[model samples]
Target chain A: MKTRDLGSAAALAILGLLAAGLAGCAPGFDHLEIKIDTLPPLAVSVDPTNVELPVGIAVGITATPFDTSGDKMDSDVVLNLVPKNQKVLAVETSLDDRSFVLFGVGPGTTSISVQVDHESRTDIPATVKLQPME
Target chain B: MIRKLLLLLPAAGLLVLTGCPVTDASTGELSNGRFAYLCVDSSDPTCDGIVGKAVIPDLLAVGGAFDLEYAGDSGAGLVQVQPASDVMISSTAGTFAFRIPGIAAMLAKNNGGVVADFVHLRGVDVDHLDVLGESLAESIKTLEMTTGVAAALAVSPRDRLDARLGGALAYTWASSDPSIVAVNMASARNSVILAGIAAGTATVEVSLRSGLKMAVLVTVKQGVPMTTSSSSGAGGSSSSGSGSGSGSGTTTTGAGGAGGGK
Candidate 1:
């Protein structure tokens, strides 16, 4: 009977130890509150924000988008050219072409603006002059 | 009526305990019903803390699409933060510690605080709500500019400086040789136009409000670029970024840029 009693006590002690070990194994750092890290508002860069052409000239415009965290975002950048006077300045008129060729269509000064995002934009003013036949 | 009332009470209690409209208490703004969130305990917070977020409309766990594992000791050991994976595990008690890279990572703007860009899903387990894979480190670290841009870019005499940064940076743009190259604007968050105004070598200085500065060389020519396309140096060092000029436009190699990144 004494041996039986001792065996039961040993079993209970082992169970208690197991319980304690399990409790200590609970995940740490689960209670302290932490907030999410954010990425800064994206910045759009239009290289050569302005351009000058003397008719029959084409220039390449590259728009780079910068994130404060430095994540590359070239895939998200959009470029559009809106010529104040289509006759004075002519672009490929595609959303992807950052380059525009100046055609002395009428020899007038017109402004070309490129839309970056939904609301942010930049412009380039072009003055076209009629060149004499070479 | 008592039996019916009892059934509804438990369900209602569960709902209240895990309800919608989770807030970031630190910012005191709604977390837009995110499944995970950071409970900013104090009014003032800094780069020391922050977590990630998810796009869930409520804080409840999903049925079975999760694959969260412990950061270490996979077998029944205490789970610390595993910064590598986007998922973070936390308990109902919510005492968790995660690592943020530095101050700059925390200051990035997003869902309106310092904890919105780390995680994408909630991985709750072991009776603990995997709070948002919440946030960054406790110091301001320097940024290294990497690929996509260069210290020196080459283009046609009339071309513009169109370049992308390897990382995000806010800078004030200025042209040392405006006649050769001029800024598209006085200041831009990330854009600089080194207009090849003339056939010359010029410098474009990009400075941050914190006084971090970088100088890029701009060379414009009508024919093959006059400058060599050798790399200047890596981030944290100022070297003339090299550009290989071809007939039409310019292409940047692995050399120079003004932001820290891969």
Candidate 2:
């Protein structure tokens, strides 16, 4: 009789655990809801694609990136200023890492290409004209 | 019966263990996402990075290894997370955690989504990595050029005409009205001699590879120019073993060219 009582109690525990396990196995149970964003940017862009600066003056630059959906992606982009005339134009990046300072060293034009990761890049044509800072 | 119960006990424990599936707990969700980054500055010397913002920074120093943390509905604060180099589990306070390495490469390998907005660096202040509008497009200034003799086409700073390709001292010149006055680029290194074939107004232009250009109106009178002068500057035609004494008059009208509007 004692064995019978012990067996029934053990069975109850097992049933209870199995019921809980079944519930846990159900969909939407305690599962790690992970959605790793894995989309490559199709286009790279910059804010104010065109910029101008006077001699001895400076401007900030912003590079933007977009994915295949044409959505502005949240990613790191590289900015490169290819000034046709470096004597007339120069660029420096800020610590903020988001903006760059364009100095009108002299007078001329440049091409700013922002690379969106290793996959894509876009060019923004920038022109700098000298206005003698009197 | 006892044996049967004993047999079920192990399975019971296993079920109980499995029951703790990481679903919506009474508190919040446990899953989250991550990313990595690298950056450079526009400063001098080593413009790679700055702990913050600065005018003068170590040149060519590119700082990197930034990341992101996006949590699901469970707003409960992160509890315990393995703060290691190889991996990161979301259910912890791993946001901006530095000890983590290879996250950037891992994400890159995954071809994960990238964010251009902001980042949190361990040794550096959290800041926006990419920004715009520091300097704006004020007014476009056109490249300046002067009118030339109708029958003669040549480059001359003395004529108040400048044409530099990529800001180099060389360029290719063309005439809008070639019949009135034609330009031959092959004849000269920096100068485009205008051969006045007839009397008419023509547009003489100088340009560079960056799409930068300058144009001016040239009203060719009856006669070809007696002498053609070369510009005297670093990239000047005159300075390049060439001579410039005079053009009819000072340059007039610095008009628009290819890259002016841009």
TM per prediction = 0.20, 0.22
> Runs in model 1 with CA error above 4 Å?
A1-134, B1-169, B186-188, B223-262
Q: Of the candidates shown, which would achieve the greatest TM-score relative to the real structure? A: 2
lDDT by residue (tens digit), candidate 2, A7-62? 99999999999999996654321111111121211111223456555433333344
Question: How would you encode candidate 1's per-residue C-alpha lDDT over A49-127 as one tens digit per residue?
Answer: 4444433222323344443344433454554455778666554421122322222334567776655544335456667
Residues B1-262 of candidate 1 have per-residue lDDT tens digits of 9999998999999999989554422221112111233322210011011223322212212111211122111121332211221112222232332111111001111222111112222111112111111022211112222222322221100001211111112346676755334455412233333334334465666554445455555565423323444443231112122332231122222111221111
Q: Point out where model 2 deviates above 4 Å.
A: A1-47, A76-85, A118-120, A132-134, B1-262
Interface RMSD of each: 22.5, 18.9
Q: Candidate 2 chain B — worst ten consecutive residues by lDDT sum?
A: B159-168
Candidate 1 chain B lDDT trough over 10 residues, lowest sum: B99-108
In terms of docking quality, model 2 is incorrect
Computed on alpha carbons, the lDDT of every model, listed in order, comes to 0.33, 0.34
